[model samples]
Target: MNVAADPAPAARPLDISTFREGGSLNARLRQMHEGLLERVPAVDRIACALYDAGEDLLKTFIDSTRTGHSLEGHEFRLSQSRSLSRLATSGDVRILDDIPALVQHGEVHSDWLLEQGYQSSMTVPLFDNGALLGMTFFDARASHAFPPVAQRDLLLYANLINMSISSELAALRTVVASAQMAREFAHLRDFETGAHLERMARYARAIARAIAPRHALGDEFIEHVFLFAPLHDVGKIGIPDRILLKAGRLEPDERQVMQTHVELGLEIVERIIGDFGLRHLPDSSVLRNIVGGHHEKMNGTGYPKGLAGAAIPLEARIVSTADIFDALTTRRPYKQAWTTAEAVAEMRRMAVAGELDPECVEAVAAFAPRIEEIRARYPDED
Candidate 1:
């Protein structure tokens, strides 16, 4: 394989910062494709396809030039095209200067390409740690469009494309893994109902949105708070059932044991981070903070670290408000659920007493109307 560095005059170095990490994967992929097309004037179309390892098929991910019949969501077996398969396996860039040769040889998928007026094409393999992830196809109307000069630039562009895709893939895997962990932890507790989790997390998001400006929080941060909020009490699984499932108020020692759930939740999530090799992800800290610090108060009165006021993680503050709101409004074995008015009045009292973040409490108070909708949507079985 020819891996010559591009010696041509730099065509305004690729500004990868333009590809927003917070955007959807498809949007980022399209942005990269458009950037590549703007730089490489000879290429007419760029299509990125992902290899579905389970099915042994390459499915279309996104297409830059959807001219002749959209191949979006189209799939083809990897074994059907020998050249492409070779490129996929060998991690080589296949520059087909002639398309008719493959057509005359009855190569799979070639006839379709020819019918679409693509005379020549190039396939750049995308790999992550030696595993073939997929391929990006650059098609042109002219033959021999990808000569040595073009190949150098193409290879450079391919590297950029690989990084963009791989990062998004990693992000996707992290999201799935985090959700799976939350679900598994919730399952460990018989009392951890899904409806409660859903309601509380949304409440967290709402509070985050309200205080976002003051705290300089972005949409991504708010999203992480919502995603990780449900795991706030995940550590309860570690407490003995005698304490965790006790129907009545506990003794001081038993209450202390229950409070240890905060530390236990942090440890559980820390283990998950290590086990999944996601310790490098900054977003993972959101989970840890919520699990460990939600109990912390604004006046240095809460448990665990006794973090007070701004010392508490912003995410934990938001989850703290949401969790309290849900707990106050939802019926438990020990107490009857408070009415909306009663819950709001009591929350205001807590905020005044400095047990809760006043700003977060205000935010939740402002979003009070949505709470009923969420509650109705995820009502208890009774």
Candidate 2:
């Protein structure tokens, strides 16, 4: 009948500074596990079971203190133990001094308890707000009762752990959603140029990596360039079919209309930025800059904003070279595909004329063999 003693009033609130620092969820959970072990000295073994509400399964996720005993094949089924199931279903805490008695009374699994040599155990349900999340199990080998104070301290700790788990899940969901959107963006048929987008994106990453060290573009910059490259032609979604899908060379007026795709792409990207509220997100502005300025040329002849030199973002400059190289090297309805050698010669010509950034052109030339590999990797649409 003895219960664990209550913890001090000051210990009521669990310290959650580690969770706030922002890293992987599993790492944070492991830290919480270690913290609990350090705080509870008397407990010989601890096993945490998280109830996946969606799957309706109780899984042992964290285990820390088994020295002599092995729990390699132990199964703690929710349906097998009436007491544990009751605690989980009813959201209550049970502290037991006589573990064998509870099993004999049909509260827990008697055979399972004896096999593990568990004399005493504590089970506390984890919850956030009103919903049940999971439970924490604290066990000892000797027959010792939990004090009321200890029960209260364990409950508080369990609640803090549950809150941290929920927050981490939310962050993971955000990342997954962002990735799905990126995938959808990649598949859009706006460019209508048949794998031109994929080739150009690869080229963009290569150019960015080549120029990164010399231009002081850090790793973060290079990574963003790779991700944002696919969106270079995103504005083509807004261009009229007559301009976007044009098979023949465009007249002066038609060319002007086709040129509006860059502006359209910028506008579409800006709208996405506003909708996602990603303007303040780390490196988001850099991504947006790439989307908006990828078509700008080194010379003043580029469309939309007509940015020149360093006025164009570094990402955009890298993408511009990639986009043109892919365009020249790939077959279009209007022109036959150029050979790798021909593409390199054309790029060199542009570099010498200062129409394209010389560093990016050189990078493309250096990676010329890979360019053929890339073309083979993503074949043109027949």
Candidate 3:
């Protein structure tokens, strides 16, 4: 009998369940990445990129890396890449047993992966319902690390991650859709155009990016701020059409009624969270703060709560600044469209008058080039 009995693998003590944290998808991804490294030492990185169909683009969302740098700020259009487009179309798993074998393509993402010393990789297309949402990537330092059995393990993890992302986005869509329905039900004329929302989101992103470093904020924090910023005015659905639609300045009493929108927004947000069972949505306070506190001022003078200085959440402060900037620069029935320079001067004045956050105003000023680009991309309706 020449059959040599197989020796059992060494006993280990890595328990993934122990690292579980509630509520944050980003936090969960980090925990999963750490657990993956402990279970399979050769696997070195896990990352996700979210798709934006409106722009035909995919941007980095979250990642967990072991001895690898994050590709946090990377973005590319789906229309421009053959490989990613194929993945988007097929929604199949892609395996690269040897990453260096594909380096001849000269793609920026591949070049970066190669430079980072990853030798093998797997890419999974993520979806919510029938629509493509984004992609998840796993990279390894060792060639042929993701063989059949190992790939089965990786696939299970991929599905878990994709579900987390899908759940988060679906819950968010519910809130936004609810707000839209509320507006239509009340016959609230939708002055907040799709273009306005797009511009404001970008402005919020720029401000959040600038302030993040100084505040030790992660890309996920900036991501949440951008995600929730557009919903800041959802409460205006509760405002009366006369005050809301007035082509002239709001009268004193009308202004006071208009100020109630912030409170209304918070109520709508809370209702959506409760009714739809979205209480577990990650970073929900960010949503509440943006909607409930955006109108608060720095000098204890503004609306519903008069939250002065640091009492106002920084996310709200950022949104308010972005909102004001867009309102000033865009053409509205009640106000003339101010030039970029004129708007900047006015914002500076507002900051000095203690009506706006000075730091947020200054942060936005740092991105003058991007401001012009966003405006050009999302212009007002004729």
- Which candidate gets the maximum lDDT versus the true structure? 3
Task: Report the poorest 10 consecutive residues by lDDT, candidate 2.
Answer: 67-76
Which ten residues in a row are the worst by lDDT in model 3? 11-20
Task: Find the 10 residues in a row with the least total lDDT in model 1.
Answer: 66-75
RMSD list, candidates in order: 12.2, 14.7, 5.8
Better of 2 and 3 by TM-score: 3
User: Which parts of model 3 have CA positions greater than 4 angstroms off?
Assistant: 1-21, 104-106
Please provide, for model 1 over 300-326, each residue's C-alpha lDDT reduced to its tens digit, 9 standing for 90 to 100.
Answer: 999987888899998998998898899
Q: What would you estimate as the lDDT of candidate 3?
A: 0.82
The list of candidate 1 runs beyond 4 A from truth reads 1-9, 12-188
> What is candidate 2's local distance difference test score?
0.65
How many Å off is the CA of 147 in candidate 3?
Answer: 2.2
Residue 338, candidate 3: how far off, in angstroms?
A: 2.9
Which candidate comes out best when scored by TM-score? 3
